[model samples]
Target: MRQQLASMLREARHAAGMTIDQVAAHLLCSPAKISRMETGRRPASQRDVRDLCDHYSVDTEKREQMMALAQDGRRRSWWDEYELPRGYSNLIGMEAAASSMRDFKSSTINGLLQTEEYAREVISSYFLPANPALIDQLVAVRMERQRAVLRRDPLPDMQFVLDEAALRRVVGGPVVMEEQLGRLLAITSELPSATIQVLSLRRGAHAAMDTTFTVLDFPPGTPLKPVVHVEDVFGDMKLERQEDVDNARQVFQRAADAALSPGESRELLEEIRAQYEREQPPER
Candidate 1:
C-alpha cells in the first residue's frame, strides 16, 4: 500500500516536471524527506499528500485516488501485529498487494504454499537459536499469508517451480514431508490459479542455482512496479530497479521452461509422497 502511494506521488512529481529540491522547497522540508516519501522509506501523512497533489496539479480524480491510497497505507496489516524479522515486513507488505507471484525454491517449499506443520518445522529448524515463541509466531504469520492465494474475490495467480532436490529432501522427517507433499497435491488439484512445476535433476545446471527468489506483479493502473525479492541466510532484499526486475523475470522464465509440465509435476509429487508414505512407520 505504501509502495503504491509512493509510486503515484513519484509519477505525479515527474509529470509536474519538478525536481525533488523544488518539491522540498515548496513543502518547506529537506530534499531527503521527499526522497524517502517517494521511495516508500517514509510514510506520507495526509497533509503531506495533499500538499504534493496541490503542487503537482494532479487531476481531481487522480488526486482523490492518491489520497485514498495514502489513507489505506496508514492502516496496519495483520502481519503488523507480530514482530517480523528484519526485511520480512516489506516482503509481506508487497505480497499482500500482489495480484500474482512467481516463486522458485531450491531448498524447500515456498512459504505461501507451505502447510502449517511444514512451516512450523521449517521455522523451528532454521531458527534454532531463536525463542520457541518467536518461531511459533513466524509460523502463524506464514500460514496467514496463504490467504492471498485462497481468497475468492480476487485470487492471486501463483506459479511455483521447485528443484527436484527440494522435493526429494526429507524435511521434518518422513511424516512431515509426506503431509507436505499431500498438501501440495491438494493445492494443485483445488486451485486453478495455482501452478506447480518441478525442475528435474536430469536438466541440471540451470539459472537460479544460487538463490531462491519471488517476483510479484501488481494489477493494472497501479503505479507500483514489479519487484523481485531474494532471500538468503543473511537477509531478504527487494529489487525494484528496472534492470534487476527484468533480469529476475528472465531467470524465472528460463527455470520454468526447464521444469516439467504441471500434470507431470503433479505425477512426480504423487510418486514422492508415496515414497515418503512408505518410509513412515506403520500406525498402531
Candidate 2:
C-alpha cells in the first residue's frame, strides 16, 4: 500500500506540473531521494511527507491523510497469523492480486493445480497428528485460491513450467496422481490464456534444480515491482531486487524452453494415465 500511495502521490505531483528535481530543491533533498520516494523504491518517511506538504502547499488535513496512508502501507499484512505450512500466505495474497504470473515447479503440482485429495495428502504429511478440521479449512482456502484459474474477464494470464519429476512424484498414489495429471491437462486445454509446459528429465540439472519460484508481474509503472517468491524449508520469501528478479525471469525462460510444448505435455499426461489404468485390476 505504501507503494500504491507513493504512485498516487507522484501522479498528484506530476499533475501539479512539478519535476522531481524541482520538488527535491523545494524539500532540500536530492533528486534521487525524491525519485525513490515517488516511485516507492524508498519508504516515505514522516519528515519527507511533511517536507513535501510544505513545498507543495498541501493542506494540513491532506498532509496528515497521506502520512497515515504511508504508515499503514509499511505495516505487515494480517495474514501472517494463519501460519501456513509452507508460509505462503503472503505470497498467496500477492498472487491473488497479480495481473499475471509465471510459475516454475520442480517437484510437485503447482499449489493452484493440486487436487483436493492430493493437497490433503501433501499437507497431512507436513503436520504430524494433524488436525483434520484445520486441514479441511486450509484445503478450502486452497480451493478458493483456485478461483483465479477459472476467472474469465480480466483474468491473470498464467504460465506454468513443471518439471517431469513433479508429474512422476505420485503424491496420492497412482489413482490420485492420474486424476491430478488429467485435471492439469484439462485446464490447460480449456484455458486459452493459460500455458503449461513440462520440463522433461532429459533436460538434466537445469536452472530450476529441485526448487520452485513464481514471478508475479503487475502493470507497468505500478508501485509494486515484479517480485519473485522462493519457497524454502523454513518459509517463503519475496525477492524484489531488480537483478534477482531479472535472473529468475531468465531462469524461467530457460526452464520453459526445455519443457514440452503444451500439446505434447497434455498427450504425455494421457499416456501416463493409461499406464496407471493398465496396472490396476478391473473394478469388480
TM for candidate 1 is 0.90
The lDDT for every candidate, in the order shown, is 0.87, 0.77
Q: List the pairs of residues colliding in candidate 1.
A: none
Error of 2 at 207 (Å): 1.2
Error of 1 at 165 (Å): 1.3
lDDT of 2 at 174: 82
Name the regions of candidate 1 deviating beyond 4 angstroms. Answer: 13-36, 39-41
Each prediction's total of clashing residue pairs, residues at least 3 apart in sequence or on different chains, is: 0, 0
Best by TM-score: 1
Residue 110 Cα positional deviation in candidate 1, in Å, after optimal superposition: 0.5
lDDT of predicted model 1 = 0.87
Residue-by-residue lDDT tens digits, candidate 1, 1-284: 88789888888998999999999998899999999888776789888999999988899999898889889888876877887764687788787788999999998898878888888887887774778888877888887877744774677898999999998888888999999999999999888989999999889899977789999999987878898999887888988888999999999999999999999999999999999999999899
